[model samples]
Target: MPGNADTLTTIAALKSVSKRYGSVTAVDRLTLEIRRGEILALLGPNGAGKTTSVNLLLGLAGPTDGKAELFGRAPRDVAARRRIGAMLQGAQLGGHARVHEMLALYSGYYLDPLPRMETLRIAGLEGLENRPVVKLSGGQKQRLLFALAICGNPELLFLDEPSAGLDVESRRGLWAAIRRLKEQGRSIVLTTHYLEEADALADRIVVIHCGRVIAQGTPAEIKNTVAQRHIRCVTGLSAVQVKMLPGVTAVNSDGERLDIVATRPEHVLFEMLRLDPALQDLEVTGAKLEEAFLALTDDNREAQAA
Candidate 1:
């Protein structure tokens, strides 16, 4: 659904793209698109070609086959490159550089950049603009990297693990800032291991595995792929007894409480209720993004093996 060529717009795309490193393929005919004014989360486990896909889009790596496009042109096109900003991991921000100064430097690279104060505000670096990069804490430095990335005020952004070093509060603050960017009609390609973050921010999610897309959909749609529901309750029924339920997949219990994963939650709940009339604090929740991710990737792997 991400590359729907109907009425929706596309900002960037990779058409049947492939990348190889010697004998091994890093990306295998991958097709992806960044939709306009949307937060698209590109998700995959470690070494799943996520970095390769981003590199191809950013023109940092040339594809072995097929094509990568930005603004409907070659990824390396100067004008197209200028319209995108990238915030990546392992960037070497010098210890001597101050926050505002670095922002000024990077902003100068673009034809029209965001104001220094605005960049600082968006990055949550306002109070630390004068602090040396080395003296700042890990989280503070992460914020500075984010500030530099947005200084150019690009129409599209590629964020790689943007909230890695942030605490809970700081991470939420950054998420809010990202939402504001989307509100301004800017498109973003976000790659994060935090499934909850993807669930919270992304309008669309693309899951890649073994160098190709395995699943792509909205958060709800993705979660729906896994029919496993979790039911937790305080009950007197033993774990063995609950596992005997017809639809129950697995059951874990700690004395008086039971945590059950089941395909037919209604049947499981009915049986549990009938078995343990004193059951309390019952909660039935849908599958989380992480659960769906694991199931999809594992299924992909199994299919390839077979």
Candidate 2:
């Protein structure tokens, strides 16, 4: 439902926007919108035009065709961007500068900057306030970037791969911070390859492939698109035999184990048990975002090739 006219007044909008680099079309006829207080994750495989789309929204690059607007104004409009914060994938901080000093410098650009200690505390960097940015670990650097992002208390945020280099704990901390931002009723646009991140945080997800938006929906909707449930069982059956069962799409065997992909999991379970009454283990799960993404993008690539 992104880019719908009804949601135009919410946050960001791209109207049939396209961007090109010589012969390569980085973005193609894209139209999407970010809703206020919602986390929208833009996902794609490499070269899917994710970065270009973000740049278009930020007005770092103009669209080759339609328009991209932030709060109904162009992305380059300084006044419109005043209420926005951004953290690019490889954003740099003053390496030798102390954390508090760096925050203070960036805060000067905003109308009402968050208190230095408050920003540091929110980002979980309180103990590292006086430490030089240069000595921070990868996760620490990411937290510093987050601190910089919220220092302005912007209403809209753009985070590009916010958890790329973060360790597990650090990533969880960052996720928590993002949720807090959402609770504050701020809109967020996040881009990351981590499907779990999208599943966990995104209110809706838009999937792009080869510069085009291929799918858009909530995580549950997207997963349901596959219409297949994963059923695992401990049984004595050959993979090919299991695949022949009604409703079964795929079957894999690992010794005495069976993994079945089926359209109707309940029916599949009944049939599996009928096939082998001694079936011991059965686990039914919906299709995951990762599986849907792979299947969708691969199909897109194949279609493009054809």
Candidate 3:
């Protein structure tokens, strides 16, 4: 496919890729592409072949069928690999090296690397240059890993669970950093378990289930896949009573509070008000990303109409 203003150039792609280990198939004919400057969030449940797909894309493992390309070349190509950076899970970053020393050491690997000072600044680790890696907190160490990943001045980055162990503040701070990288025209493949993180940062979300793409779209588009709405309120209505409302799918009650899931929220709310005029704390909202995710992967839910 040709690149246009609206459809950006593809820097990396997995075309009908399938990875099999023994008789078990990890990725089943997965077709994915990474645009030049967009953040593509890869989401899936455990054992969903997310790791295997990433491994194929990064050339850590080869596909049993189809192809994995990096910069239009085989993913393992030396020149192509030079343009990529990755901060994968279970990486061992230890010993007594200081933050600055670590950055300097990683910078030497690439032919063209960002200066150690610049890498530190971009990673929000300027003043902590002298701190030992072992002494850093969970969040600080994560930032250090990010710095190492970017010091190579790579065009593409694979960040797997970048904020896994972070507190709320630290996670948001990392979010800002990721946004900054995107603004710099870096393509990032983010594999994260945090749905909200993907909702907040992804230019597009690709949800995988059973080694295949179950859904892929912009956040709004992905949310629209499910027709359900959420209604929560403190009312005098019982679960049995709310369940009787039109379009209501599920109802949960705790004392005077109730949570309702429905396909037609407007219809349900109208009936709710008529039945319980004293209802307070009433809030009706569209489906959350989490809700859509659950509904999309739900085995009990009928097979996707598409």
lDDT of each: 0.85, 0.84, 0.85
lDDT of 3 by residue, 1-306 (tens): 124362478889999999989999999999999998899999877778887888898999999999999999998898998899988776767879998888888888899998888888888898999999999887788889999999999999999878878899888888998888888778899887667888899999898887888889997776556568889999888899989888887898877678898878888898989988998998888876566567778832356543
User: Candidate 1: where is the Cα deviation over 4 Å?
Assistant: 1-7, 232-259, 271-291, 302-306
Candidate 2 residue spans exceeding 4 A from truth: 1-8, 226-247, 253-258, 274-289, 299-306
lDDT of 1: 0.85
Candidate 3 wrongly placed segments (more than 4 Å): 1-7, 226-228, 232-247, 252-258, 271-291, 299-301, 304-306
lDDT of 2 by residue, 93-195 (tens): 6569998888998888788878888888889998998899999987888889988888988889899889888888888988998998887777899997767
- Per-residue lDDT of 166-282 in model 1, one digit per residue for the tens? 899999999999999988778899887666788899999888877899888997776555467889999888888889889776788776678898877998999888878888999
For all predicted structures, in order, the TM-scores are 0.84, 0.85, 0.85
Tell me the deviation in Å of residue 283 in model 3: 4.7
Order of quality (lDDT): 1, 3, 2
